[model samples]
Target: MPAPLLSLTWTDHVTGRQGFLVVDRLVRGVCSGGLRMRPGCTLDEVTGLARGMTMKEALHYDPSARYVPLGGAKGGIDCDPRSPEAYGVLVRYLRAMRPYVEHYWTTGEDLGLNQDLVDKAAREAGLVSTIQAVHPLLEDETEARARLADAFAVRVDGLGLDELVGGCGVAEAVLAALDRAGHAHAGARVAVQGLGTMGGATARFLARAGLTVVAVADVRGTIANPAGLDVEALLAARDAHGGVDRAALRPGDRELPGEAWLSTEAEILVPAAVSYAIDEVNQQRITARWIAEAANMPVLPEAENLLAARGVTVLPDVVVNSGTNAWWWWTLFGDIGADPDEAFAHIRRSMRALVERTLGRAAADGTTPRAAAHALVADRLPEIADRFGWYATPRKDAP
Candidate 1:
């Protein structure tokens, strides 16, 4: 991985709130990523996430190509999003980092932060709330472009554009994997861990595509039905209570232990929750033949190696969950006249292509898709750096 170009730490004097920003790589003097607020987010975590963002952006649509001029960066505020002081803390944090926000780093919401909270904080800080300035820069005069810009600007409050696009991308990747494995999508069973924004969206889209979402797990517990759980009911339950509502369980629905979602008998499993959900300890228990990472780094490096050894096709997060970054890139640099359906179709096509390419590379090289993805990005980065003159000159104290 390339070293970060800049690292900054700041604290709000009044609130004593602390945050860190890491610019992992920059292209054309611009970097973009997300701002996550959590209780124990560390500088190392933020730095790692920034590096992932760089790979995600570079390999989002096509691992063999670079689609956007933007680079990777990430910011994290060490505060509890559930606290009543979240709003105030966010405002203060954004104000403290206003110069960086405007000049170098543009961020949207991630993890504990929502679009509404981000917009409120950005407005409070007198900064543009939109993820990227789409309206003024877009040259297309089509009605679709205008609607897309409007939707991108508002982001539907809590749902957000990232969730919508990311979910669609995951579903698309699942289909691609299913095809590669010689399975049909309609009757295939899927187990999903984590029913938050990304997970919920993924479940919804997969169900819409005719896949049976046999099991879904949240922080509260896991719910399963061999015949297939009702995706609509589960989604409504999650929305109403922010998790699986045990009270809303239907006749055949059965609750299992939280970790049981991993062991469920299914063809496809999507871990869309926290980082390292499938670590060294539980990697042995994963029964699904295909693993599509809908969350960032859900499968640790060692765990992925074990899965690969077992002949389970593991799609890396950089490829499977890159729709958010791709959406942001398109909004910033793609053709503005694309309608929502057209835009989403493009995302699905791109993700499917990447899945096929990565799987092919893995087969040809006898490596896991994760490693193949890293090799592809590593191969492309140097050419981009040299062409754009972004190579960091060595310094005496750098190493």
Candidate 2:
């Protein structure tokens, strides 16, 4: 495993809030990742997530890729978002670490943090944000302007960026996987585990794309219908109840244990919740033909290996769910002169191509897609390192 380039921990004297920032790699001169604030957030979790960011950046980078002068890093604060002191704590935290944050790392929202809060904190700390700096420029085109306007409005309301694009990306990847497996999406069944932003968006997109979302799960429990559930109604109910409300179930929908979502017998299973939700113990119980990771690191290595051995097509998170990062890359480094619609169209094309290439490479090499992606990055890293002076010269007297 590659060690992080730098790790820094901080504590707020007033609120007794503590957190850490881990920069796993520096591809260029800068590093970027999300800032997650949760009660159970830990240094180890942040470190692992930082490393995952590095892998994500590596997998996304190619010689012909656009200029993305960023590495991978992650930050977390051990405080619950529901706490009354959340805003004050975040401001102090950012004020204390402004220099490091401004010079070395750029952060957006993760699990418990939202972009609006981050922006507020950044402003309070006298720190300029890359997101804020570039978001305004995307308003030059009609469609892009509308999208940015909606995203900005949503952010102001403390909601995350529109997950429609991300969901569309997931749906596209599912279709690609099904096509590769010689299956059709028309009437294909998909079970989405989690009704949060990503999972809910994915479920909606899949349904819109003509696939049947046979089952859906949230913190409350799983509600399934073999004949397809009304995704729009389900989302509305979830929004009202903070989860899948049992009272909102339709006549044909049946509520089952949350774990039942994992074994719901679908062509595609999307684990879009917490990390490591599918592990060794329950890997054998998975009944999906394809496992698309809509959440970060949803499958542990052991579980992934078991699934791969069993001939399940596991679409890695880094590739399938890279829409957010890709959007940021476009905003930060894409052709500013181009129309916003054109820029987004380019991203869609590139993402689809990446999925196709990774799947093709995996098939040709007889390896899992995750392994194939890592191998591609591994093969390219030395060259990047050499160019960026990341390599150390060997000493003549060294043993």
Candidate 3:
């Protein structure tokens, strides 16, 4: 049996305190993951994420026929970050598991913790802090690492991390789908649901890409403007928690049911808000030929099947959002620069490649984009699992 590419280790130092490290694929390139904090999160989940990261990096680095092994890894802390004491405790927990912080086990931000939290935790754990207030050159490196970490953290702290990835990944996938359909981003009408980090980022990116963002929705309500909503203006009006000031929206903006954005007449619909936002009930009302899953599990599997049957191509989350997190992992322990633009560029390339590959697979299989993309990962899973003996015999299902 092949040894596992992914391994899980846990340490118990402080009483009632525990931490886990999951090592995914061991790419000759670089392997990276995040430290997540959540209530009731199990070790199994962390390991699964590590494995996913491995596949993500593999698919991203080489989406073609060749399966180049790219290392992937992740870690998680079971705790809440809302309290100051919990924050300190979280740091101590990370410190206890510092031995795993390496090129193979490099960690970044995940659910429940932000970049600030990771930086502080790393500091407490005695891992060389990314911050360098002393050396000028070191400071540049520190700034770059911090921004990359911050991007991953904010995705979790502000909007649910999974949701953000799903939203943005789907947005990119939608753009690819539109291109396949011969539709253009320039002057295309768009509506976004769920205006958190993922939704907000998608809306901003689409607008920047020259799409006419006509509407956006959050948990609070929906805001629409047929003349194209002002992305920057709306962003400026957002509260500390990213809530938009409905009163500050443009004159034509009017409040409607939170789910109303799904039915808008826009040519592109981005459900960046929440899971099941485009379920069976409202699936038929979706007027946009292009629908992106900005939130994880946004469409029920059955619903997704239905959408594919009806000709709407859905982009899967695992493939699309993998870039930002993947880039964060690579740059954190490597020679990444401090400038945010440079960091963003590194991630965009990975994202663009995955999108192109997924689209190509869809064209070849005559299936939904998600299936084609997932198949790429699924097809490789066996060789990987065989190499690790994960599926030896009756599927041990070992933890």
Candidate 4:
């Protein structure tokens, strides 16, 4: 892997918390990713995520599309999101990274953080918008911003449209895998970890698609029911941090240890919670035929190898979770409007094609999905750079 163009570690003065920013590459003088706040976040983890963002961007590139892919970048702060000091630390970190956010990096929510909180913190830190760095590329900045805001306001069921797009792509990927294996969606069992923006939405989509969401894991623990838990009730009962209230579970629903989601009796498992959630040891307990990475680096490479050897398929996060990032750009760049149906149609078409190509590439090359995705990215990035120029030298007049 190539080195990141820039990497910085920041120490919060007020709370003494540490934060990290990694710019894996630059395209047209700007990069894009998300900001996550969680305890034990490290530079290494952010580096991997930033690189994954690069792949996600590359895999979605269409020369004729209005939303051209940007470079990769990520920001992370090491502090518990539940702590009172967390918001203050977030504001301080954004303030410290303001220059980059203004000129080079465009970020949004990831993991412990949400877009609402990020936007608020960005404003308090004197940022125009979390993604204002790309304003220069917009044909009409005001109209584009308004379009994106309207899109964000759109909700399907009870969740914001933005939150559902990623999960939409993920569910589509799962469906694609099932199709390839000739598996029936009607009764396929699924277990998902993390009921936040991604996981909760994923469970809803999968359940609605006729797949039984037999188990879902929140910060509290795993909620399991063989006949399938009530996804809507769990979603309604979620706290801001993705924890489920015990009272919301159905009569037959049982709570298990936090890690029980891994061992749940399910054909598909989604680890959407944290980095390295499935390591070598824990991976041994997973009986799921397919693992979709809804979180960045949820499966370590070694564990993935072990699973692959055991006849499991691991769908890489770059393709599965890229829809959220792509949706933002699609709306901002006028590729799609504020319509939920249009947005979902665009996501499904693009994500389905992407997943099909990735799986096909893996089959032809005899490589893992992650490796195939990486190869696709490796091929596309240079073409993107050649056509648009990498903008290796930072522009002095950048705002």
Clashes of each: 0, 0, 7, 0
Backbone clash tally (model 2)? 0
* Per-model RMSD to reference: 5.0, 6.1, 7.9, 1.6
Query: Model 2 Cα displacement at 223 (Å)?
Result: 2.1
Q: Candidate order by TM-score, highest to lowest? A: 4, 1, 2, 3
On lDDT, the candidate that comes out on top is: 4
Q: Write the per-residue lDDT of candidate 1 for residues 56-85, one digit (tens) a residue.
A: 867753333324446788998988888888
Off by over 4 Å in 3: 1-31, 35-51, 62-89, 92-104, 129-172, 273-285, 329-350, 378-399
In order, what lDDT does every prediction score?
Answer: 0.77, 0.74, 0.62, 0.92
TM-score (C-alpha) between model 3 and the true structure: 0.69
lDDT (tens digit, per residue) of candidate 2 on 46-121: 8988877776666666666544435678888999877999888888878877776755676777766656678888
Sorting all predicted structures by lDDT, with the top scorer first, yields 4, 1, 2, 3
RMSD versus native structure for model 2: 6.1
Model 1: residue 27 alpha-carbon error in angstroms: 0.4
Top candidate when judged by TM-score against the true structure: 4
Which regions of candidate 2 are displaced past 4 Å?
14-17, 62-66, 130-161, 240-248, 335-344, 386-399
Pull out the clashing pairs in model 3: 25-71, 27-71, 95-125, 144-338, 166-294, 167-294, 194-273
